[model samples]
Target: MIVITTPTGQIGQQVLERIVDSGKSVRVIARDPSRLPQRVRDRVEVFQGSHDDMDVVSKAFAGAESVLWLVPPNPQSGNSTEYYLNFTRPACQAIQSLGVKRVVGVSSLGRGFGRNAGILTAAFEMDALIESTGVSYRSLRMPYFMENMFHDLESIKSHGTFYMPTAGDQVLPLCATRDIASTAAALLLDESWSGQDSVPVVSPDSLTPNEMAHVLSEVLERPIRFQQVSIAEYKATLSRFGSEAWVKDYMDMVIAQNEGIYDDDLQKVQPSDTSFRTWCEEVFKPAVLAP
Candidate 1:
């Protein structure tokens, strides 16, 4: 059996679909089973609860051969480090007790920046805990998702601008979530590879924010611009909604990004098969045009 956490999530849903197509016995841990597509419900066993719950994961991990582990984002989390670690610790125990042979986890880039990278630091710690479980593991070290632009959809449509807490000229690596899902599904299905490794799923293009704005303008046929906000301003904006810890961690992550956190010399990276312009023309354009 293959166990998937966050099966209703963007990348997880895609991964579940692909794995289901292979005719494998699959199970998922979700808070609300109703959120799962009916077709998915028919094919996989549903453990209706958060994966962080020991009872939920212990039950789901039982007799599973492989697992796809993804730590869902919680912007409202009181402590980002504790949030990631606490969510992962239960699954690590379940992996050991349940004799699960392999694991494919969603993680981020910027492993060795030697600073508090907020969420990225938390992800790295999650990767470590999972690895310590001694299960054969594959950490899909992902870069910035192109779909992150969707958050600024309203801003793009209304003001012709998108905001970021990064230098305009810094080349931000990008990857589509579909590519991340594809990578995870492939690893989850295959039982051949053993031990642990990091698969850096980054897109081939090396585009700065200014270049991204240029592509958006041509694709949408509008005058769109990239606006670089200061870290202080970004923190202030985030502070309006979430808890103080949440705001600090998010801002710290952005600070790490501005400090070149994702600028690691990754070797043997099999570039993800999506470009910024392709994403703009295909994904972004439709999103902007949608009513």
Candidate 2:
């Protein structure tokens, strides 16, 4: 049996879609079963509740061979470490208790990446804790998500501009969530690999925020600019959006990225599908260019 957590989320939903279509015996843990699509509900055994709940995961892990784990983002979370691990800790216990062998988890690049790197640090720690459990694990160490660009939809639509806390000329890695989900589905379905490892899902193409602005402008047929904001200004922006709880930690994370914490990670993994231009044309342009 293959168990998936957060099946309704962006990555999880795609993973569930691919897995269910293969006609595998699948189960999911969700807080609200109604959020699941009608077809999905009909297909998989649903254990309704947060996967953080020991009882919920325990039930889902029963007779389970492989699991896809994704920790939902808690933007207002006070401590990224606690927020991530608290949810993962229970599953670690359950993995040992249930004798489950394989786990494919969504994680970030940089293991000892940077100081005060909020959720990234939390993700690095989560990898450590899970590995200690002696379970065969594949941690998809992802870079900046292109889908993260969508968070700027309103900014793009209104002003033809987007913001980030990085040097505008620095070439950095990026990937789409679709690639991450596709890779996860491939891993979870096979059950052929074993042992703990971190897999980098980085793109072959690297671009600066300035270059991204040029591509976005050409694609949308408008003048779009990339604005490099200060860490304090970034915090102010987050605060305005009611995301102040982890502001300091988030600030450190962006700084770490700009500092090139994952330069080694980028060199490690083969580039998967999805390019920046493709995402801009297919994903970003439509939302901003729509009537």
Candidate 3:
């Protein structure tokens, strides 16, 4: 049996669907099983609990051969590292105890760089804790998620302006969550490769914020301008939205992006065959037009 953590999330849902469609015995961990879709809940066994609970995680890992692990973001924690470690420690211990043969973990691209990458530092620490479990593990080091860009869809629809802290001309790596989910599912299903592999799942194309704006403009059939905001301005803007911790983390991530810290020398794994323009047309445009 294969076990999945946070199986109701954007990427997790896709992973769970792929696994279930393959006729595999699947188990999913969630704090509330009722939150899962009726289709998924019917196909897989649901373990109702959080990752931080050792007894719950241990029970979920029982009889599972492979696991897909994800560390959910904790914005309310006083220390992000501690919050991640709290989840990782128990999961790792459980994995060891249960003798799960393979694990595919979702981690960020810049984790290896440590504190030089700001909040990603916490992700790096989680990677360390998980790897120490001595299981055959593959860490999916993903680039900037295209899903993250959805945050600005409302602002773009309202004002025809997309704002970012990135330099308007800097081409940075970006990947769709669908691609990450597919790649992660493949890794979890295969069980061929072994210990401590960091895989970079990046898009084949890289684009600047201005270029992305042009694509959005074309997709929406309207004029859209890219407005690059200073770090301070970005922080102030996020603060106004009542997300102080997110503001700090996002500002730091922007700085890391500007410094090219997220630029890893690893080969990329391309999946989904979805381009930025296609994503804008199919996903973003539809969402903007909805309601």
Q: Which one wins on TM-score?
A: 1
Q: RMSD of each candidate? A: 1.2, 1.4, 2.0
lDDT of each: 0.90, 0.87, 0.81
Where's the lowest-lDDT run of ten residues in candidate 1? 261-270
Instruction: Give TM-scores for every candidate, taking all chains together and pairing residue i with residue i.
Output: 0.97, 0.96, 0.93
Best model per lDDT: 1
lDDT-superior candidate, 1 or 3 = 1
**Per-residue lDDT of 253 in model 1:** 83
Question: lDDT, candidate 3, residue 29?
Answer: 93
Residues 15-93, candidate 2, lDDT per residue (tens digit)? 8988898878999998889999999999999999999999989989999999998889877778888888898999999
Model 3 weakest 10-residue run by lDDT: 264-273
Candidate 1 per-residue C-alpha lDDT over 50-129 given as tens digits, one digit per residue, 9 for 90 to 100: 99999999999999999999999887888888999999999999999989999999988889889999888899999999
